[model samples]
Target: MKSFDIVTLTVNPSVDKSTHFSGLIAEQKIRCKDPLFDAGGGGINVSKAIERLGGSSLAVFTSGGPVGEMLKELVTKEKIDYEVIETETGTRENFIAVDDNTNSQYRFGFDGDVLTDSEVEKLLETISNLKPKFLVASGSLNEGLSSDFYQKVAEIAKTSNSKLIVDTSGQALKKVLETGAYLIKPNVGELAKLVGVERLEIDEVNEAAKKIIADGRAEIVVVSLGPQGAVLVTKNEYEFVPAPNVAKKSTVGAGDSMVGGMVWALSQNRSLKEVIRWGVACGSAATMNEGTQLFKFEDANRLFEWLKNK
Candidate 1:
């Protein structure tokens, strides 16, 4: 059997620093108050959310330098188990700015340094050993890595008898779908790109999602529609799960939170529809918080109750 419940893989993790400003101005002194920093990157966000929901998962990735050190400190504080491959380049940092008045947020992201072949190989070797029940790989691939990076990880998960859940966009997601991933969670925009067309209505979006399911590329496909809710497409069924109406806070890490919730529900042997219910609850919960604060068990439980009534 499975040694661990979940294992998260992030190729490019970062230290996310968020601050707030009253307004925005170009070429002007825009000083904000104190900033908040947290361990980031999609997979890390997922692992953190899982921990908050009273579940534990391992976080595996590569890091180095001062920022990486900060990441390790926060991970230690969270009591997360992680296996990091040391690299020459430091971990990257992402900045987010929120305007208290308009409630609009602006984000700036830096490109993490490229990873050497040996560094990538080290991560693969680690995956070979753990063989957790669920392999959750999220976030963007760093520079100098081919689209086949996720595909290669999927192959590793397959050989290890682990279910692979991918949360990525563009070619990285497309390539993995072609390789038949166990599950894929993509937002509306990512779904449109995968369908090879743009400008889709609900029906069109449903059709596009079915194409991937029909191809047998992925057994489960989750398409998240911002306010319209989400759709889950499986081999034999396609269902739409409505979202709870909520207001306020930032939307960062919502997708990752959804993936985390889905994996947790699956570990509990919940049905696919129940998994989607928890996924929506977690996604909605994450949006109710500011900065990198993801979905906690309390919020997730509250949202689950709201989902039952709705």
Candidate 2:
């Protein structure tokens, strides 16, 4: 298995279409630029981000209908390896349109079609067989799929001795925590909820993360502070890396880029210090790109260097 085969599972994948328009007028027609299509979802974006850093990962996701086929084509175009679980219903499509006059983005998303029991079983089977060194389960679970599905994936990870890195929100994340994970990336707001608090101050971030680790919910907790950068906390070690200021074009995929960077670093056996820095560097670098695109290796490397000194 090459010592560390990284596998990413993205069950509710989407074909993301991004474009720009001048303005939004209720009564008038709006003209938009030609749309750019990209395959999207949590784990898939993570795979794409890893590829940008010159690493490889298997993006295992569910696909159906023409939209699903197009999504696969896009992933192939990126030169990332993948395993698909074909479904009866079509994959969902997400729309992101930017208003040029305001420079604000409006995102509209649709729920993915439900998967049959057999398809769901195939997903679990594929994950079990891969037995990668690191398994990442990101994005939202489908409508009919229970949150306990992640609970099952967590169990599979445990049985396979795979380090599971999760980057999901809401009940799905909660379920993974219950089963325990090697790592999880939750934004500060999500962290607050996990600890049963309304919010957390900057200094309190470490304590909040430590609480989860202390409970064995996760071995390592990475809190995304957005533009403030991110922090990595374990039972005994803590590292905080501040984000370097940059010209950000879009915020899409920044969090996934962070997860991808950290997972790739983990596969390389990089230290936690290096891991967090690489994560912050990749995430911040992702914002410097246009819509639906991730970071370039050079930008991420430069940012990592800057973060290393800090």
Candidate 3:
């Protein structure tokens, strides 16, 4: 297999199905438009977002059963290269429906099949073999998968000299901090939880993230503040880029897009300032589309230009 500068890992991927409905009512059949199925999950969507920006990444994920097979087909259709690990159980599917009347989006998610111990080992082995320059481990873990899973990945990255980018929450994230990573994208709320705080004011976000940096838990911590924007903090430097306002159609793949943009930028040797802006640019651009459609390159480029001046 050819080596890629960037590689993404998704343990609990899903086939995302979305559609629009007239209204939401119980005990009555509400008609909906035809559904649209897309390959999703954190790393998969990150790969898709990278592709949208004319960058390439190899998506590594587990797949099994019929839904897993469909997920493979969807990825192929996207023209993204991928390597799959077969699992004893199938991948899961997620549903998103937009209420046309109120324009509210309701999302329903299902649990993915539990990964066996052997499957987990295979995933790590495959990732170690790849040894990409940038290793992105994103999304939630499957039931029964240990919270230390990302920690194990962190170790492999350290050995391979790969820059690890972790995007997760809770214990898994906590464990990753033990071994440390090259980068972590934690929202403000998650950042507060990491430092054992209930809430954090905007001004306090930098100090909290700096604490993590001071502890050597992460080399660079990017704190995402949703519509408010994001702040990138390192041991010596800090940069905050405000989110650009746009006509948001949906926020389906915004976070993943941000990761994709930042990783792609890093791989291209972009400065930290441009990296965060590209992240915000791609993220905000993703909201300009409806339901898991990521972002168009033109939209992202325009947004990036507009952000460069900010």
Candidate 4:
């Protein structure tokens, strides 16, 4: 087994198929453009994003049946090192379509195949043994899996002294907070939910994140504010970096790209300010591409430079 500075876990990986159509009409056969296939899931996208930034990480995910095989091939094509835990059922596939006329993207996601008890154990064992500097558990839980899955990963990271960065929502996110992670990236809405609120205004973002940090739920809390940029909150600090304006294309995988950039910067021992900038830069640049293509290295670099001066 090869060693890695960072390791990403994707229990519910997917084969993402995307296409474009002129318009969406009810019960009508819509002619669409050629389909594009990409491997997608939270951790998988993060690993892909890390690679774009000239960094390497071990991608650990579950694989089963034909769709799983195709997912492996796609990850391999990206030149990412990975480890797979085989299961009994095939992986799920997601569909994304864009209406060229309205420029609206519609995404249809499917439930992942359930994992047997043994398969779950194997995944935990693999994670325990890797013991990387950082452990990132992202994406949703599959059917038949407990919502406490990420909480278990958090416990493993705690015992191994690995800094855990989690990007998930709902019960999984809430559960993981109990074990406490090093960092967590929740958008304003998700943050609001975590803190038990209907919504959070930009002004209240800092206080909300500080409450999490105060409770030791996370050492650093990053709340993504979309076009307004993002806010980084620690026990004693609060920093907000504005998003640079860019020609928009698609938003797929943008959040994962942000996590990837921030994690890679942390691995390199960059300052918190620089880490947040890298995150925003990567995320903003990802909007320049169609479908799940993520960001271009040149674009991210340019955005990062512009952010530094602003």
Q: Which lDDT tens digits does candidate 2 get at residues 78-106?
A: 99999999999999999989999998988
For model 3, the superposed segments whose C-alpha errors exceed 4 Å read none
Runs of candidate 2 with Cα error greater than 4 angstroms are 1-4
lDDT per prediction? Answer: 0.86, 0.93, 0.94, 0.95
How far is 41's C-alpha from truth in model 4 (Å)?
Answer: 0.3
Rank ordering of all candidates by TM-score, starting from the highest: 3, 4, 2, 1
Each candidate structure's TM-score, on Cα atoms with residue i matched to residue i, is 0.95, 0.97, 0.99, 0.98
Q: C-alpha displacement of 49 in model 1, angstroms?
A: 1.0
Residue runs of model 4 more than 4 Å from their true location after superposition: none
Candidate closest to the true structure, highest TM-score: 3
RMSD of each: 1.7, 1.3, 0.7, 0.9
Better of 1 and 2 by lDDT: 2
Global Cα lDDT for candidate 2:
0.93
After superposition, candidate 1 runs with Cα above 4 Å error: none
lDDT of 3 by residue, 1-310 (tens): 7889999999999999999999799999989999999999999999998898888999999999999999999999999999999999988999999999999999999877789889999999999999999999999999989999999999999999999999999999999999999999999889999999999999999999999999999999999999999999999999999999899889999999999999999999999999999999999999999988889889999999999978
- Tens-digit lDDT string for candidate 1 (1-310): 2367799998899999998888777899988979998899988888988888788899997889999999989887888888888988999999988988688988889888999889989988988898888999899988888888998888898899899999988888888877778889887778888877786677777778788888888888888888888888886777788888887488888889899888988988988878888899999999898987786788888888777644
